[model samples]
Target: MNDMLRQIEPLIPALRRYARTLLRDRAGADDLVQDCLERAVNHWSQRRDDNPRAWIFTILHNLAITRLRSSASRPRHIAIDDAQEETFARAPSQEDGLRYRELLEAVARLPEDQKSVLLLATVEGLSYAETAGVLGVPIGTVMSRLSRARERLLKERDGDRGAQPVAQLRRVK
Candidate 1:
């Protein structure tokens, strides 16, 4: 329907962004978004009208979880082309770029639950209630997971800073 298109069209970018953060791979994220769109279209009649954003997100999140779980059970195999592509990947050269990469690595190190909560809340700009609805968890659980995620990231940042050598002053008098 035209009404459905009008509503869903505006949400594609957000869905793609959320999918990218969830999967950590651009191609996989795009595929997941496509699958989610397909599923959403097929189930449009069943979805509650009160919150289509949350509903769509819920569908994507569930599909992502299923994909992640299934993938975890299988051994990972990188194709020769993919491995060769990694050799050509650019490394961070500037201090800001390095810091940004480190931040991303730190986020990647977070437990899946905490990472999901953090991404949905901060990266996707979802409120606690909306995040909880998408994740199918209590709002309090979302709050706690987000709190723990922030604490862990802070600790990781502090640890990285502490790992660097500090310059000591020499007595030159």
Candidate 2:
């Protein structure tokens, strides 16, 4: 319906921006938005009268959350597309590239819930409240998980298996 289109039309860019922040890839984010739009069109009859924007956003947010969770569970592998630009930029040797790949793999090994919360909060720049709304959790839970995720990422980045204090390294290895 024209009414539905008009309401959702303005929200597309916002949806895409949020999705891009969540997925960290423009194409993946756009695809997620398209899927959300398709679902909205298909289920238009079921939508309630109030706050169509929130409803549509909830759908998109859920889809992105689900996707991030699933991606976290898969076998940890560095994304080729993600690495290509960095590879070209650095002109690193094969050995250095392998080290970078290992770092990515370690990040992938983190708990899915932590990864999702961190990405939603830090990468997407969502408010704690917004992340909680998107993730169906309390704001406190989001904050705690974000803290844990940062800690875990720091440990992995340092290759420190113990709870030792991490020293800041100015140079990239």
Candidate 3:
């Protein structure tokens, strides 16, 4: 058990990073990582010594997927702070913040599966094979989804209703 904790200790940062990317919020991501580590600690004694890293990763992946699925069934809405919104609205540089807002909205528009793959690959810096393992998909599928994700992001950012005109042009062009 002590050896298992020692082995799993190094995975905490990686787990937190992956969780943050998956959840897109610091508090939610930390909760997810905490949940994952708790599960890992509870199950560590039963784990085989062959590949602990893969085992922990699999647990985290499963938890994130399950939560995402659950969240999908609900209506999507951002819980913006009214006060902050009002303050920002009154700010002189509101235009700059609008671009940030638009980009975030575009990201929110992505399909969950594509977002997951993109986050796993880019934010987590997982290799193709590693992402495939985490996503339980073929490497080819990972590549295809990643390509599609990039394409969709470009389209969203470039559409007329997207962010500021100059920023959209810079992104699309």
**Tens digit of lDDT per residue, candidate 1, span 1-173?**
88888888888999999888878877788999999999998999999765588889889999999999999898767666656564567985899989998888899899988998998899888889999999989999999999999999999889858788999999998
Clashing pairs in 3: none
Instruction: State the lDDT of candidate 2 residue by residue for 1-173, as single tens digits.
Output: 88888888988877897777567667779999999999998998887655566567668878987887898888656677666565457545798787876655665666767766776677556678767776788999989998998897777777654677768879778
Positional deviation of residue 82's Cα in model 3 after best superposition, in angstroms: 15
Q: Give each model a TM-score.
A: 0.85, 0.53, 0.66
Lowest-lDDT window of 10 residues in candidate 3?
Answer: 82-91
Residue-pair clash count for candidate 3: 0
> After TM-score superposition, what is the CA distance of residue 22 in candidate 2 from its true location, in Å?
7.1
Candidate 1 off by > 4 Å: 78-87, 160-173
Clashing residue pairs in candidate 2 are none
lDDT of 1 at 33: 97
The 10 consecutive residues of candidate 2 with the worst lDDT sum are 83-92
Relative to the unseen true structure, what is the Cα RMSD of model 1?
4.9
| lDDT rank order | 1, 3, 2
